[model samples]
Target: MYRTILVPLDGSGNANKALDIAAHLARANHARLYLLHVPVITEKNDDSLVTSPSQNDAAMQLIQTALETIDVSDLDTSILVRKGTPAEVIEREAHRLDADAIIMGYKGLGRTSNEKGGSVSAAVNHRAACRVVTVR
Candidate 1:
């Protein structure tokens, strides 16, 4: 039933697993995929400065690497790299793109949660306008 699918990746193994699922679903539903990578910038409470330029560069490289790992030769796909909170950016893009659903990985790199989904996944699932599928 999905037409436009949003896939948020963090360049982690878990995000790649979710990419596989999103790709399959896109193929089955004849849907287009929107790939989003958010380079989060964490700062000290003083908020004196944003993340270093080097950190942003590394995040961009990770996003490019993630793109290389996927084969979108047979699917309609779009890639975006943004700077913000992962969950907020994903949700905003989903609405902006009018995505029918969001497919994302539940596990995260350094965050932990008692729930199966990570903090970002859980937040997006709760705040998104459409359905959210979190792959473990």
Candidate 2:
């Protein structure tokens, strides 16, 4: 029943798996697909991390490579790159695009990952206006 499907990617294997699922679903339903990459931004002087520009470029390149590796001839696809918290950006884009659903990969962060309280998937699941599918 989905017309427009949004798949958020982070250049991870998990996200690539989700992309495959979303692509298959899109083809079956004759739906359009939107690929999104949310660039992770770190604070200034966070020497432990690279700058946002470099990170964004790297993430975009990875996304491009991933898309190239997919057989997307059957589905219409669009690419989006944004800067912000992953969950917030994903939710906003999903709403803005009027997508029927959001398909994303779950990192399967266990207790250790969620010890900080809320995970990105949790936040997006709670805040998204459309249906959210997490492919683990």
Candidate 3:
């Protein structure tokens, strides 16, 4: 029933599960899978920018690793790495991409990682205009 599905990965177990689920849904519905990663910026550069080469590389690698674990040969997929609050970037990308569904991890690498639904996923679940499925 979904035309475009967005799956945000954070290198977490839940995120990996979400990717697997999203892949199945995409294959079933012939939907486009959008993989997004918002890297955790541990330090800022001299220009006070939150983004760095290492951060970008890590984000790309995370997505690549996730993609490799799944069979995406027949899937239309795109990978994106953005710099912003995880929830906000996900929400914005969902809207910008005109996604029909978002399947993401229930928890991420946040202070509330032990919680059932972490802040970013909870926020996206509430803010996304499309259907949101949070995988634990």
Candidate 4:
């Protein structure tokens, strides 16, 4: 039985599908859902990572939109917008939150895979300590 479920959203249709599945799982198990959106940190001319309000806003908006599409009104849910590599942030957050399971899309926005030939979901699946459910 799951007590805490984490779903990483990227505003992609697949990610939204994963959210729906996660919500169902959460409801069935009486679990809490943690929705996470990670905004990529851009590098400036000086090679310094920069985060702007707009970036954060976009992440929040993505989460909000996903929430609006899902029927999780009766479920306990938490939203988080963090700036970092999507895979790393999701992995760390799962550990930090002590999540029992993670449900996410198999592929997200942009490139299908990373430089290592694995997508963000793949990386999280390989590194996470808890159960990983990848929704196609």
lDDT of each: 0.82, 0.80, 0.86, 0.88
Which numbered prediction scores highest in TM-score against the true structure?
Answer: 4
Q: For model 2, what is the C-alpha lDDT against the true structure?
A: 0.80
User: Which tens-of-lDDT digit does each residue in 1-136 have in candidate 1?
Assistant: 9899999888778888888888888999999998887765677446533666777787778767876787776999887877666787889999999999998888768563324455888989888999999888
Candidate 3 global CA lDDT score: 0.86
How many residue-pair clashes does candidate 1 contain?
Answer: 0
The candidate, 3 or 4, that scores higher on TM-score is 4
Decide which is better by lDDT, 1 or 4.
4
| Residue range 18-38, candidate 4, lDDT tens digits | 999999999999999999988
Local error of candidate 2 at residue 95 (angstroms): 0.4
Screening candidate 1 with a backbone cut-off below 3 angstroms (N, C-alpha, C), the clashing residue pairs are none
Query: lDDT tens string, model 2, 1-136?
Result: 9899999887667778889999999988999999998766567464443447777778779788888877776789998988666777889999999999998878732231222477777778888989998878
User: Where does candidate 2 have its weakest 10-residue lDDT segment?
Assistant: 107-116
List residue ranges in candidate 2 displaced over 4 A.
Answer: 43-53, 108-116
- 47 in model 1: Cα distance from truth in Å? 7.9
Give per-candidate clash totals: 0, 0, 0, 0
- Each candidate's TM vs. the true structure? 0.80, 0.82, 0.88, 0.91
**Where in model 3 is the C-alpha error above 4 Å?**
43-49, 112-118
Whole-model lDDT, model 4 = 0.88
TM-score winner between candidates 2 and 3:
3
